[model samples]
Target chain A: MEIPTQKKIEMLETMLLSRKFSDSLVELCKIQGKIPGMMILSTGQEAVGSGVCAALEPGDVIITNHRSHNHLLSKGADPKELMAEIFCKKTGCNKGKSGTLHLAVPEVNAPCTTTVVGGTLPIAVGRAFAQQYREESAITVCFFGDGAANEGSFHEALNLAALWQLPVIFLCENNLYAGAQRYEEHTRVIDLAKRAGAYGMPGVIVDGNDVQAVYAAARDARQRALEGGGPTLIECKTYRCRGHGETDPQHYQPRDEIKQWQEKCPIPRLSDELVSSRVISSEELKGMESRAEKIVEDAIRFAEESPYPEPHEALEDVYV
Target chain B: MQKLGMGQAVNQALREEMHRDPNVFIAGEGVGVSIHVNPMFPTTGLLEEFGPGRVKDTPVSEAAIAGLAVGAAEAGLRPVVEIMFNPFFTLASDMIVNHAAKLRYLSGGKSSFPLVVRIKSGAGFGAGCQHSHNLEAWAAHCPGLKVVMPSTSADAKGMLKSAIRDDNPVIFIEHMGLYFAPMPVPEEEYLTPLGKADIKRQGSDLTVVTWSGMLGPAMSAAQKLSQEGIEAEIVDLRTLTPLDKETILSSVKKTGRLIVMHEATRTGGFAGEIAAVVMEEGFSYLKAPLRRVTGPDIPVPASPPLERFYIPGEEDLIKAAKEIV
Candidate 1:
């Protein structure tokens, strides 16, 4: 479960980059008249994405949900194309058809993203089924929010995945709130990981903000899957700092609770860890932040310069 | 040539296609282990031949089944999924319409979805409203889906091969009533291409355009009409989406009259689409207004007598053809 110093530093860099990218989107929405489509920011839950994705190989497939910018970036999706997608430009990953809610980069082995809650779980099971059938030593990862655990598809997908012993890691990023509804308010089971037991799969819980904790759990779960040990549900106990979307108001969440969670921000915590462990100096950590900010700025410029797709292009990709 | 039932023809097609392509596989609820030791009709001997890996038996989770098929298709497998009946297709519509149909387009052509969904449809055997509905119109309305319904054994085999080979998602509708119905099928390999209509019977008086279960009643009516010297041309529209407008227009132009028919309710059946096409393109050639012989807008009742009244029969088609002519 021990991650090398270089890998830990890369994980920190990815987490920082995701945070900067998410913050930039919020800023851009304020300046622009509107964010192209629905935008769900994964601001506070970077460790889960960075940790789980870092554990995966290039051939591994990951299915993501609406709050997918972090997952895509952690999985090595191009920031420029993703930004172009957010702007609905023709140069986007999905040719401007799928906005923020549905961005996919097949080049990174992340083939699909869905806005529907719990939608990607079954598809992930399917990808794993294909991998198992082909006898390929690749695993499939599915990322979803707390709300998705209540969906019937989650139960079905887990059952099938476990029954077939398919190579799949069901990563539940429990971000405490599902579109303003608190996790406990929606589901009686506070621990989403425990639900995996019903399907006879190992259920592990991790401190989602702690990068090493999330990374260790993900590494173990992925290893078990790749070793023909069936699926595992690893619930990362996390929180979302911002409102659900750009239009959502801050009426639902308590201000003090938000402050408490923000105080434990993953980027700063990981940065502090990296510095204290002597993995890197404080100046090096500062340099990574600036580099991440520069990447986000360049991506915004690329997206702004890209042209909108012609109206006729909408009719082109429906077939083939 | 061999005489085979529609179900046997379908089974033959699946076996041949699986043998032909390594990526092709079948999955559904009762596919791997039939209640009886003997294999079921359409999936006969599939488990024994391919083993449980390819002939997968799944839980009664239609949504997951559909999503699994879509994902597997995207990941380089040609998956043929079977929904026990057509009405159950409603459970999987989200996956079919949103994911399977839209994947290729949403990916900007980076992905190709080659998935086939087979569902048995139509009213017969007192299966009740839940299991007896023919909802091909719903699938045809979706832009990214191809809808196909084959009536004969040969067409059952041929169209399925074509559907499996198709690069897009195909909704393959099989008629429960026609599953055991015997028909002639060739032993040689063939494919009934998508977007093409077949002329079941050629005549010059009036064109009877129909598909699936309705083809039987229409043919019966066409036979009865022939006794009275009315030669009705029967045009079987095998594929609903990417519809065979050329054959429909040409037939209507030659016959100067058109009667569109389907087993589904008249409210929003694909007959309206065919009627509109003829009205728009072959308006001047039509000697009479386009007519539709379809089931009433009520659900298929469970009682035999009521069901008989509910389903459109040969008499209805004959009456409609006589009135139109």
Candidate 2:
């Protein structure tokens, strides 16, 4: 896949925005005592969200996991409403019902997020089945973590998608840790991509920190799905540079591993590649970073100013 | 009017709904070939009429079946999925209880989830504890789900049609014992609205509250009571979630005596719910103490004689009605 200069710059901007947005949430939790247990940041995994979501069209659907701020922003969710949603404000996307865990932005075609591991896999197949039944050209993208691969839903969803020849892309982000346990401790299969072949689908491994590689793999997978070739499983190997949650004690993750992954942070990596390749200058990269920082600041202000939902509002929306 | 079995009525409801809406489809294990051969099952002849795209035969994966149905319903399609038996519903409860039941509210009431899950319930076939447990109370306990259990063939066809057209997720439970029992059904289009109780027998001496498989035994007991000048009015609660408390109170007010009967075990059965409702709202009208007759708190036995004893029968209803009166 040939990368255009403008598209590369856009991808770079998205990755920076995701990093800034995620880091702001972490700061809010650590410094301001806001969103305590809800802060599950995807700071090091920005490239995966930016690359995969950029390849999707308007009508395509995305079913993501709990660590979903990057995917929601990359898929065109409004930052102000998303921030307000995390703050439990009435102006939030789901009217303060979902809070930070389950963010559903139907306008962006990202229907819902499930906090349960591997819960979105079978749903993605069903959404793809709907697309196929209607003869629509769009596909569904399902995102999960390394821990979800061991779930029974992973096997059942993959086999059903392949059996029905549905248009779905099962994108697994292997960050080497399922909450606190190491990935190796959870499953014997080191390379998660190999499991896709058992379901009669093509599985590809990509560098999750490299935006261009992730984009190329996602673009090809989307093309194959649209052409009626069934689903594809793309395993993006990455690292969680921070603890699983804001309140998580750092007693389990080794310090050396954290430093090593921080050195390969996706935002700075993308900036260096873009500058060295003459796609943009150092000043332009700095300008992009400042712009993203401003957006995050404005979102924070909007969330702080938003009103909390009334107590009586809780009784509503339980039924249609 | 024509005679139709409960299973055949269910099939007719599915066929008519599919013909009315193109987006309605059925998916389950052996829904295409295995179930179609029975001719009276709900999926019978659907594969032939709707083709393979709509009538999907899947692997024996209950979680996938239910999760996919939730996804499909979210994507603007009406999916009527099946969970083979009531006991197996536990395997798919995460999707049905966590996702499907909560999605609409999670979406802030912006999304309309239209899906129906047909679960076969009851123990008359002696399928043992795993396959024949009555768990309607479990489904009714959920806030977002609409639980419906129809007793007669006519009510089965009418309520099944209403459940499919409803915009909320419905847990439609059918008893295997009533599948082949023939009853009079109207040929013209009609529907039995959900959340309403039916007066199966209109007597005034006492009120026998029952539904689904227990309605048969209650009606038989009511017939025998009539010979002894003990009139028992039976209130068949068609839908359990959006319960028809108005009808129940009215029936109790008229009869002045109450007896709650169900096929499930006595502990934590839906009979407790009915008894509590009568105690709270209709206590002043009651002439005698309420009686509840239910299965013993034990797993359903597979042996024929033990199974017959395990299930609530007309004798139990008669004894309970006699005591309450």
Candidate 3:
């Protein structure tokens, strides 16, 4: 599908920025051992996070899983603060308490992930219920993997959201494989969107690699939610170029599958389009990539120079 | 003067609180109606009076119910959640641990988790292992949760009322053994503070620290000891979290011997904490070493014969009292 000029230009910029950031994180992983073990990268799925978050307001709440660094960045979290959190510096989003996957910045209304599978969905339902109770038109969007659909909490939350008519958008980033297991192997129901249909809400499937597509689906669902149209389920079919985390060998993914998705690399597809459309040239695209590299370097420098927290600081945020 | 059980006292408290606060309401698995009726039956006639929205029967999803209550409590409503059994608490732990307990602290003390979770506990009446467990220690260990276990009819009524009005997450643990047990309770507006102990009997020989169903047997043991001229002080700790250390310490000082008792397993029970407190505060006054007469370390068996020996009763209390003094 031919995308619009403005959409393509912005798309390439955001996706390339995500790719650059994650790539730099792997390098940081090499130098400082920052990411504890395996770090899941939205290298290919960056388009989905960037596009959906772009349509959200500051008041709207978004929650997701441990694979959530891109979501926070797209939701307007300061990169330096995010880097500080990962580095365990005092300047971090959770004051250095939370790392890459569990970042919560109150300013953007994006909270930390629950870390466990299928945890955030029910919590999102509660938040939406709270919003509705206050008679506010705010909508809550929950991001989870297709594996989460198999969890009871996923069903409980969706059922409650539908029953209460709570404003929540269940965004399933179906990256084809939940770790090593492919989606079709475990789930009898091939389509997760159809699971939403079982709850009496519309389930839409979209090209998660396409920023315009993800944004269109997200914005429409958000409007429907804000208008008290209950909950909608959007299954974004994407791919995980990176393993579950930085630690995974990614031996489970087939070579052909990886090659196929790499060809549709969200960053390059839109970048080439922006370059050809004259919205941006190949030189500017290269310049932007270099700029992203330097930005990441500065973040690393800031994080490395920042002092580690006091030992007692461990107990400070345990409750709060 | 009125004589009623703690469960009746709780029913009285509900009747009174519903009259007092329009925002106060009860909801849970069977608060309104059930196929087998509520085993706890704490919400009889409440659904009719308050409507399903207030005194509603939720689906068999404790997490959703608790989450719904947390949402309501956050948005200016007082909700009382009835978890049918203490074992069922696992389903609501997310709401309890993640949200309700941490909301006040997370919001920088700006908000209050004004939610009450009433759970049925104790293992004396043959409810099987899962249905019968005294898990109050879990709540006592939590930072923001206020754990209250009332032993008398009056205290149950007063404490439940206090819990409904208090701006904190309160777990009102009701002992199944004492639901029908009778005591004198006033039919008037009253509130027992969240963290205070009541001295059941005056004595000079020994101090008995206990709560929940154990309080009755402790009082009976104290009375029997009193008849023999060996005075035993009975201190009932109505609340477990902000434990009534002051009352416990004073009673220990007066009697010079402390014996803590509870129906929960002894390994990590709340009564163990009381023994620690007595040792910390009244170490010099002890006539003998502090002792804890508690349930053994085993899952509550379903057999009533084995269960009787498991839960501390009058005989167990008498044996402990005589052993100390």
Candidate 4:
């Protein structure tokens, strides 16, 4: 089922605005050095996080893969908390203990997010499993790259999820790479969704850069899971366009390939659709940009002023 | 009361806890996979009762399993994670030490991590170095972790029930050899609180303190020595972290001599820590310097004959006990 053209544009704009915010984080890494060991740039894969996160109710749980940040902000973690986390400030979501990699916000039910590949899948499955055991209607939405699908836990967890019909939406952002390695280099078959058939489940592949398409697919998958339709594998075909991590210079990717994907940037396309359909005037989109600029500006100040955690505090939060 | 092995005792404890508390859930590999290794005929039917949701079998992600348990506990679920191979505890130490142990304290005592990590440690059954490691001393070294090892079915049931109930992270280790060691455990609801030690055997001339699988050998040694008119008091330090210094020191005072025994190798073993405590606090009560009888400092050998040499036996305990007295 296709989402209406108008609603599609709105969702796509939200994705566009979020991508603008995260792109600022990347630029600030050069402007202010807020980046750390490995900054997982959301770059071209913004639609998956924005789309899946938009469809979820505030109380609904969402867990993201290592290539996160958009998932955090889209799910509504404090902008300051996310910025402070990337900057290693005590005011961050995990009190600076989680860093840019591992983060969580329990109040909104983003209890934890991990930097380890394929690590957050079982946790999302467990969170949903626990919610189901308690008879709550909250469905867990797990976001992972296509690379995570190749992990053994991916196979085991999805198989278990389908067998048990757990309330979870496995959102696969098929950005087509495991760091420097292309997705095709790892998996035996290119279409990752085809593998879901082995688990007796439906697999949907979509253009990840199309925010509304991603959103509609997420809403349908999550609804089915919450209503006991079991698990569905939705592969959002996207690109890593930039490097995998900040340290990932992406030398393996050819310049022409990067140029082509950059030309398909989701924000410009969405902004174009919004203006052409008269969903919003160009002035209105520009106003959203100015507002986002103010938010990011304030976020940067908060990150700069927040004090670093004491060395002793590093020894803390090991358990709770 | 029913006669049960250590494995059944643990299973019963888990069942009783889950039945009593809606928040309690047990997870790990092979827990629901026909209880792998044909480890027991008794725990075979538990999967049918609890189902995979509660008694989950994981995909060998030890770190993720422990970390997931931490998050679940934070979200208000009491998770008892079973680590299939005891030595694999090394993989989960980050969550266990950094997250589970320190989380409450770091959170200004606002949050409690009611997570119990169950591991079957120690060498036996020809499973050499990688599979076997007595982690009592290592776990004891951590401030936030509460370590427990039960040699008998009764203690296994009672202590596990206690560990599961305690509002803290606990590393409940089990010696593999004691899995089949049966004892009459209560069928009714019960719990043996942690930080309490039991005087397994009474004596006057010398005191022998031990735990885990060593409890058996130490007791046997004490019993065998009674014939020689050398009365030896045997105390089992069940909880390793909060060592029962009162029991250990009191026993050492009465006997005026102490001999510590452990399956872990001599240096840095749980016995060394106990010996140091006695030397520091119970020095005046000692008629002779404290002595330790432990496995030699070496990787656990696989050969039955060589393993017999590596692990401390009843003969070794008897000899050490006689020498100290």
Candidate 5:
């Protein structure tokens, strides 16, 4: 699949924005002198989210795991409300009910993101089931980590999705770790995409750091889904630069491996590719970075200015 | 009015709701197949009537079934999925208890989760401990989910209609023992609103607080107690979570005596919740110590005679009522 210059530039801009958004969160935590509870960042895997989500249209649904800011941003989540949700403010997308770990933006069709490892897989299948049941043309994109593949629901969901020929793309961002447990040690399957064959769906592995590769694979899968062809499992071999959460000190990880993945940070890599290919100049790339930084700054300001929800507000959302 | 079994009434409700709303659909293992071709099974003839799109027969995947309902509910569709039996509910609890029950609250009430998880429960048919446990208390304890258990055919039809239309996740538990028993059901459309307790029988001597399978035994015990001039008021708590505390406390206030009854075992049964509610709100109204007529805290035995011995029966309800009276 040949990538268009405009789409390439758009992907670069999304990756830069997502990276800045994540960086702002870390900076905010530093200023607060504490990491907010249950905040998981997708630092080095920005390209996978940007690529896959860029392939999705407006009506497509997205279900992701705890490391979800990049996916939400790539799907066009309002950064202000997302940041406010992290700040536990009333203006947040979930009205302070779901913090960073369980953020959901319904307007962007990214409803009900979970922190549970394999929790989003089945839900994604159901979403696709609804789309097919209604005879709608749209599809669902489910994003999970390498650890989630080991969950029984992963097998169950893939089987059901394939059996029913539901319109869903199972995107596994293989970040090499399932919350401090190395993927290789946790599961015998080194290549998670190979497991998709057990369910009879096309399984493709892509260079997660290469935004173009991830985007092309997701676009083809989406096309197949729209054509009534069953679900596809696309495994993006990616890596997370930081500890599972902000608290870990990286005792379990090998320093050299972490250094290697960090060196391939997708944001700068995509920017360099766009510049070297003459699709965009170095000055233009610099301008995009500053623009992304400004948006992050504005989002932080909005989140900081938002008011905390009242104590009674906690009881309001327990039911319909 | 027509005499219909609980399963037939549930079928009527599902058929009516599915016809009324295009967004409504039902899915389960063998839902569309003929294994449960008995008329008493709710999904009988549903696939033929509604077609495969709405009546989905899934593989033996309970987690996916529950998650399918949760996801479909979030995506502007009302999915009424089945979890086969109560024990299989454990396999699906991560989705039911954790995801389906908590998603609405986690979304800050912005998302309306309109789905019904229908599971067959109770300690009859000698289905062993795995299949016959009444775990309504487990679902009733969850905050964002509504728990409903209908004892009569009328209630089965009426409450299911309300559950399907309600803008929340509802755990609709059907008693396996009650499925075959025919009861009066109105031909006209009617709904039994959730969170309201029905007075199965009105009397002043004592209040029999019960729900689901125990309602049958409690009513039988109520009939037996009337011979001795003890008029027992049976409070059937149709919905457990949005518990009809009003009716329970009112019955307790009137009778000044209460006996909580359930087929579930004594330990951590829903009876404890009713007993505590009465103790907290209507303690002064009590003339005698409140009693709990419940099964022993053990797995429901597989043997028919042993299971009969394990389940709380009319004898137990009568004994408890007599003691409280």
Candidate 6:
């Protein structure tokens, strides 16, 4: 379960990159309103995406939910194209069709992101089923929020995945709140992983803010899935620091709760871990931050320079 | 040529396609069971031939079935999924309308969702309102979906094959009434292309455009109208979306009149779409106002006598055609 020092640094770097991407979006949104559509920022939950996606191979599939920019970045989706997509440019990953919420990067095996809660759970199972049918070693990882667990799709997907022993990892990023509704208010079951036992699958809970812990759990789940051990539900106890959307009001969440979660931010926590462990110096961590910032800046510039899709382009891509 | 029931033709199409491509698999309730043992199911004998891996029987989870199909299709497999009844399709509409239909477009053509959803529709065998509804209009209204309804054995075989090969998601509708009806089907390989209409019976007096379960009634009405000196041409719109507007307009140009018919309810039916097309493009060609012979705007009745009244029949088409002619 122990990750190498170099790998740990890389994880920290990926988390920083994801954070910088979201940070750039927030800044751009404030300055010029450059985003063509609504933004679903994955600010506080970068480790869940970084850790889970880091466990996946090149061919492994991951179906993500609406707040999936971090998942896409961690899965190695081109930041420039993703930024262009948010800018509604022709050079974007989805050719300006799918904005932030519905971004897809098939090159990285993340084909689709559903805006509907828990919608992609069964889809991930299906992909795993196909791989199992073909006897491929690839697995499918599904990322959803704690709120999505209440959806019928989540239960059905788990049941089928277990019944067929499909190679799928049902990774629940338990961000505590489902669009401002706290987990306690939404469901009686406080531990989402416990529900996985009902479906006859291993339920493992991980520290969502700890990159190494999340990565170890995801790695084990992926291994189990690929070996025909059926699906595993890995619940990462995380938090979404920002409001649901860019313009979401702060009336639902208390300020104290936000401050507490913000203090436990995955990026700084992992950076501190790396520094305290003497795996990297404080200066090295600062260098990684600047590198991530530069990447985000380059991506923003690329998006700004990209041309908008022609009016007639809207009629295209409806079919083959 | 071989005489086969519509259901048998559908089974044949699936068998041939599965045999031809290793990537094609079918999943649905009762599909894994032998159809000969269970006469009510269309996926007879597929399980025995294809084995459990290719022929899967899932729990009654429509949403999961649809989502699985989209996922499998995107992951490099051609999945043909079945919803036991048309009404049950509503449960899966989120996946069908939002995922399967929009994935290709949302991916900017990076993904091809070659998924086929087959549902049995229409009323006649006392299946009641829930099991006997035609929602082809609902499917055709979606821009990214191709809706196809086969009325005959040949069309059922041909269109199903074409739908499996299609790159986009196709909503393949089979009528409950036509399941046992026998018609001649060619043994040789053939495909009825999507977005094409078939001229069932040609005439010059008036054009009667219809499809699916209504084709038989429309043809019968056309036959009766011919005896009355109104030789009504029957245009079966095999594919609803990407409609064969050219054939419909050309038929109207020749006949100088149009009567659109369908088993779905009259209001907001696909007939209205066809009517609009004819009105917009063939306005000058119309010798009479566009007429429609469709089921009344109410849920299909459970009782046979009331159902008979609810469903548009040969007499209804004949009346509509007479009004236009």
Off by over 4 Å in 3: A1-17, A32-40, A271-302, A317-320, B1-26, B34-41, B69-79, B94-115, B141-144, B153-169, B177-198, B242-250, B276-285, B301-307
Tens-digit lDDT track of model 5 for B63-104: 999999999999889999998889888999999888988888
lDDT of 2 at B110: 72
lDDT score at residue A210, model 3, on the 0-100 scale: 79
TM-score of 6: 0.98
Q: What is the C-alpha lDDT profile of model 2 across A1-320, one tens digit per residue?
A: 59777768878888889888988887787766465246788989998989998888989999998999999999989999989889888888888888888888889988878888889998898899999999998999999999999999999999999999889999999999998999888889889999999999999999998888898999999999999999999999999887788778867899999999988888778788889988888898899999999999999999889988899999788877
- Candidate 2 residue lDDT tens string, B230-309: 99999999889899999999999999998988898998898899889999999999999999888999999999999999
In order, what DockQ does each candidate have?
A: 0.77, 0.76, 0.21, 0.15, 0.83, 0.84
Candidate 1 per-residue lDDT over residues B8-99, each given as its tens digit: 89999999999999999999898878774532279978999999879999999899899889889989899999999899999888889888
**Where does candidate 5 chain B have its weakest 10-residue lDDT segment?**
B28-37
Give per-residue CA lDDT, model 4, range A97-215, as digits (tens). Answer: 66677666666677666655776676666667776777888788878887788776576668767776878888888887887888778888878889889988989998888787788
**What is the lDDT of every predicted structure here?**
0.89, 0.89, 0.78, 0.78, 0.90, 0.89
Residue B250 CA displacement from its true place in model 2, Å? 1.6
In model 6 chain A, which range of ten residues has the least summed lDDT? A29-38
Residue lDDT tens for model 3, B215-276: 87888787787788778888888898877778888888888988888989999888778878
The i-RMS of every model, in angstroms, reads 0.9, 0.9, 4.2, 4.5, 0.8, 0.8
Question: Rounded to one decimal, what is candidate 6's iRMSD?
Answer: 0.8
Model 5 global lDDT (CA atoms, 0 to 1): 0.90
TM-score, cand. 1 vs. native: 0.98
Instruction: Count backbone clashes in candidate 5.
Output: 0
lDDT of 4 by residue, B1-325 (tens): 6888788888888888888887988777767775364544324556788776677766566766776677677667889988877778887766676667665553334457788999888887788988977777888888778999877888888999899888888899887777777778887888897888899888899988888899888888777899988898988888887778999999988999999888988888888788888999999999987788988999888999988888888899888777777
* Residue A158 lDDT in candidate 5: 98
lDDT of 6 by residue, B1-325 (tens): 7888888899999999999999999998878863347443479888889899999999878888998899999988999999988999998998999999998888888998999999988898787889888889999989899999988989999999999999999999999788777789998999988899999999999998999998998888877888889898899999999899999999999999899889999899999999999999989998888898899999989998999999999988777776766
Runs of candidate 4 exceeding 4 Å displacement = A2-17, A30-37, A310-316, B1-4, B27-75, B81-113, B121-146, B167-169, B179-188, B195-209, B224-235, B241-260, B264-292, B296-307, B321-325
